[model samples]
Target chain A: MARIKFSTLTEQMFYTLLCLKEECCGMDILDKIPEMTDNRVNIGSGTLYTLLEQFCECDMIRETKTEGRRRSYILTKTGREILEKEYMRICAQAEDYRRFFSGDK
Target chain B: MKDTKRRIELYSFFDHSGIEKHLEKMAKKGWILQKITNLFWVYRRANPQNLKFSVSYCPSASEFDPSDSETKNEYNEFCRHTGWNYAASGAQMFIFYTELENPTPIQTEPSLEVEAIHRSVKKTIIPIYFILMLLAVLQGAMFVTNLISDPIDILSNSTSLFTGFGWTMLFILFAAELSGYYLWRHKAKKAAQQGEFQESHGHKTLYCVTLLAVFIGFIYWIISLIINSSYFELTIAVIMLFAVAALIFLVNGVKQFLKNKNTPAKVNMTLTVVSSFVLSFLLIGVVTFGIITAAKNGIFDRESQFYQSLYLDSPPLTVEDLLGNEELSDRYITQISGGKAVLLGKYEIRQYARSGDSDAKLPGLEYTVTVVKARFMYNFCKNHLIKNKDKTEGGKVIFADHYEKTDAAEWGANEAYRRYRSANYVNQYILCYYNYIVEINFDWEPTASQKSIVGDIFS
Candidate 1:
């Protein structure tokens, strides 16, 4: 069975939405992810291009400005909501791991 | 030494890993990828370097899209920032290369890559293959039907046999390609779920072998035609071949010209398709008109003095042998035609009175001799000839016209059948000998002596 689109955010998708919160140009997100993660994670250029297009189509991102071939985008309300849900899901998993390791019910 | 080279590469649309590895090898040999067309992949001379290559798909991109379209430009800008330089693109496929040792790859997500490849293949190769497979199936079905209904006609002609073989080979090739791609996709999707990119290696050997076989078959067909056909037939065949080549060249030229002028993708495609249909019809019309004109000019006339003299030179059996009239033999015209295929060979000889001659009412003799080459086909050929001796029309059998078994010893050592219509005897007989089935018809009934002569000459 195929995964439903945007049902759960992959690492690259999560960071991409996080970078677009500031209305940054599309190419800047490629570098911003690594900088924000202390060089721990990086998104490929082709991957970012395709993700941005798909995001725009699903109304998760909207174009903010255009300068020739360089375009800036900002996260939509739906995008922010999805990102927050994913963040909470990760925190819940961490809490469960901590509880099990500490021998707590 | 030439600085540019072109080769026909038979890479599947989704075989990105294979293509990338091939390009890397080419780069090491100092040939850099430049451009790709439907027929050829072109490369330019460059200094040898250990470069890394990536193949990515843009599902929405059209081959007719302008080179500097905004979407393509923006995509290129994104790649340039990551140190990946554009190499070449054809249809929905894009290739990039980088000199950096650890440059970021163009595609990193396995699932996304698979989705993009599927989209691109659906938009291009899938439909084309489906259409070709349908045509092949239809042709193969027709060939089978002909083989069942008229086995002797197909078995005796090299052209028909080759056509059937060619279509069968094409169907196998296309079916294998389609099934192979789908099976790969199935496995690749499972691998992608495990965060891996499955490698794709198509049946390149099958493609090469099928193409070579078809080419050899085509050459054999042409040679057979040349050996068996007259000059007029050979000329017509040459013209048809040239016409087909011209049609392809002219259509592609038009499409390229429009693309160069920055025509919109939809308009360019529409115009190209419309022009192809028009040009095809025009070429067919021209060929038909030329044939009609040639016929009007008596180019196909076989009754000329030259042809008459050639036909008069040799005839296996004549009416003179049966009627014992040497003077009447000079007024008769003879025609001989035959062809051979793998299964069998057939030749027909006809001797009749010349047109406009006072002896137009003279008797004529015609006979066809089928020589079965393969022992396995001998019984099949013999049975078909016997069964087909009866006449049928509009899905109903004509009971009045049929063959009745006769004594074999009269004709020679084998079986024989004489024809009858409405309780009246017809001067026709089907004689079966070892490896030969002869059907002979006479304007008048053949005497026992005449049958003996035919059995001796044709057995």
Candidate 2:
């Protein structure tokens, strides 16, 4: 079957999970995404957390600890798996596109 | 009025305040207050030509923003922002967009790093679901074990917390849990699809704990009974159950306390070393049991009094009597017995809960009678209410569940919307014997409304 690109909703979810892979809480997540993108993309705390929340809701983000004020999110095995498949999917799709249209390298 | 079907529509959940400040933000996205419906604010962008949608909230936008009146611009921006076949509504803050061919869930532009996390989350939940089911099974086994051993064990523990006034309420809770467990699978599907983290979490943890608590109560009984020589044994069993449940709560509570320190409600005196007082006072002397038994006997001087004490019908009918539809049911039903309306009608139980399937813990059957009220008999069988006693039917036994009067807020939930969302698998049943059906007495007040306001419009 032909591969497809990630939608914006999935993009928000993936990046939020990546940002949350480390010591990111709700506030940290709110901050890190804008910094990583250099202000190019900005999403609401509700929207960003809502997507990562789906991961947590699905038990994909087991909580670690709450330090001063924020609850931290760590990637679950399921989260890591989702990330990997999306990565390979992009790779496979890019490879197919290049092979058919742009040849070498 | 147009013969054409209306356009795409969707609804959203928001903190009432957040939606107020962001009305224009939402309005620009093609949402506006609904004029007609009660406690509902509608949002529509029909092209005036095709699509239609509605959103509902209790208070209108005027309740919040007094100054800025117009909301047209927000609707325009929403219409221009996306390229989709349709969008139904964007009420409060959530935007629900639908396309001609519904969009496949994917991220269009993702960095290599971001792609990896999604793959991992997918793998983790498979086992989590399994672990959750196992936990549920373990919890159910505990209830079964306890019921098989002693019905009085659960009754006593419940009476301790709720008192005699709580029997009906407790039964309701048990019933809700029993029935709710079946519908809980819907939660798994709904949680996976919707973006509400809190509801999803509640569904997961409550399920594990409900069955677990009953299990703890069951085990406590056996241990207490064996070590009955000492008053300390009973105390220890009670305290131990309380402690284990408390410990689980305290661990989670302490974390929440630290996170939400700014909120005053979080300052709740969550955990304490109150066992010292409990040990010192020692309420487990033979006096306590003597008093309870005496209360049971003395309060009901006559057999009629006995029925009143247990909130049962005066003339106890066998399961056969309730099932067979005897003629006496007609004689005593409509008359004004003693000053009250004698309600004796057997609702033909033709169940029609299309939304309720076998996957549902409760089959969602409603009694076809005077009216189907969600506030009646709590279902004990659903949460796999354990039966150590004789089964009237092949595997059914009747027990009173009287924990319905608990204020939802006391349980740390909003009472209006909580309903029986986290109840163990108990359903309210009308067990029919031969003729007269022993069901919820209409005189009995109920737990809060069976329907929840939390996700009412959408869920």
Candidate 3:
């Protein structure tokens, strides 16, 4: 439930959402992020809590249900849209670098 | 090659001028001073790979060193000679060690005997303070005479209080440093007890801080005494010195405390240092307070005329002529003790009668004598302070000086003294009596003098 748009995000939070492409809990999100990123991006308990709290408040993510005591979260349409925008930004920058390397720039 | 690092312990003789000299000396060794903390100088070598070194002064170490037995004995003798500012090292809280290479925070309760030895150790500055105190007493007229005396007189007068004040400061600075040390050590000790002494490899900073504190204290006192000033001035001077001093301790202590929290052993050491640091400051403050009080009250010189005037072997008392006004009355009773005499003072005997006398005479004077009573008996019915704050000044004067206009003239018949408030008749007579252990203990002395004093009033 991500609500407000942020100008920039920290490395841990950015990588956390990338891991949370599906419904996942805080620990699972932390576990998945570094595992997916080949252990490059590590999120501690505090960082995960802060980021999840912000995303939930912003309405960009929604909690589906609570299994035992842990809550699970999935991105809303807005959250996916924001994630897609970030993806495109990196893709476009990557393309520019490709052009420079291939002498197309 | 790494720059030849130079780290020196600033002893009690260290001063700002001395520190400047130290810095100057360091500069010559290609080490440039970086920052200053209370009494520490952090420096870095100008050479490549930047080898860093820190220096601080602590005057107590020489006393703390067990190697110097003669010095230790002299220090003990000095403690006997001085009052409060004696060797504080004996307080069982502070200990000293030196010539440490890569010294780390030590974890253990400082030994009681080691602390005692340290306390008995003489500070380098105390003998000088004693001499200066002597000079101040001889130049008593200089309280206001500095303007006429040579420029150096002001310098001479100011130094004693300052030196005394500086020695006083060691209590604070040393305590602060020791507190940090103790906290670190205690934390270390606790962790070590739990089999976890995660070595805090290069914590020579704590040592530097301790040394700096002692050094600053020594120098401050040295400087304070060298300049012309009063105790009041020196108080502000000491406060300012400590204020600047605290900034360094707080910053360094906080950083170290937070960083050490990550490691259980380091955390234990940190805990020890923090608690010890607090107690050290408290001890320092209390010791300094005593020093300040001494400075204020001053040490008496037996040869002075002032002492001669104040000298008295007996309880000398003066009875002033009674001055009674329409609304006020007073009798001054001064006392000079004869061989440490204790005056039970006087109690009101407004009413007197024969051995078994029971007469309801006029209420002008009506009272009873009761012995074996405490100083003040609280009256539940009267919600008021019946006595004055100062018991020595005696009880308050009622119906005198400023008699309330609404004061009643007399008491009604069959009336209890408690019935009236401010203006009761029988006018709350301030019962005055002196418990004199005479030649005989008469349960009831039917003396004429006693009767006359009470009159034929309420018996």
Q: Please report the candidate that would top DockQ against the real structure.
A: 1
* Tens digits of per-residue lDDT for model 1, B347-370: 777887788987557988898878
DockQ, per-model, please?
Answer: 0.73, 0.04, 0.01
Instruction: Specify the poorest-scoring 10-residue window by lDDT in model 3 chain B.
Output: B315-324
Each prediction's TM-score against the native? 0.89, 0.25, 0.24
Q: Which portions of model 1 miss their true places by more than 4 Å? A: A1-4, A64-66, A102-105, B302-315, B318-338, B348-360, B388-415, B420-425, B433-436
Worst 10 residues of 2 chain B by lDDT: B334-343
Q: What C-alpha lDDT, on a 0 to 100 scale, does residue A14 get in candidate 2?
A: 61
TM-score of chain A, model number 3: 0.85
Model 3 vs. true fold: TM: 0.24
Once fitted onto the true fold, the runs of candidate 3 whose alpha carbons sit more than 4 angstroms away are: A1-5, B1-459
Native RMSD of candidate 3 (Å): 24.1
Best-to-worst DockQ order: 1, 2, 3
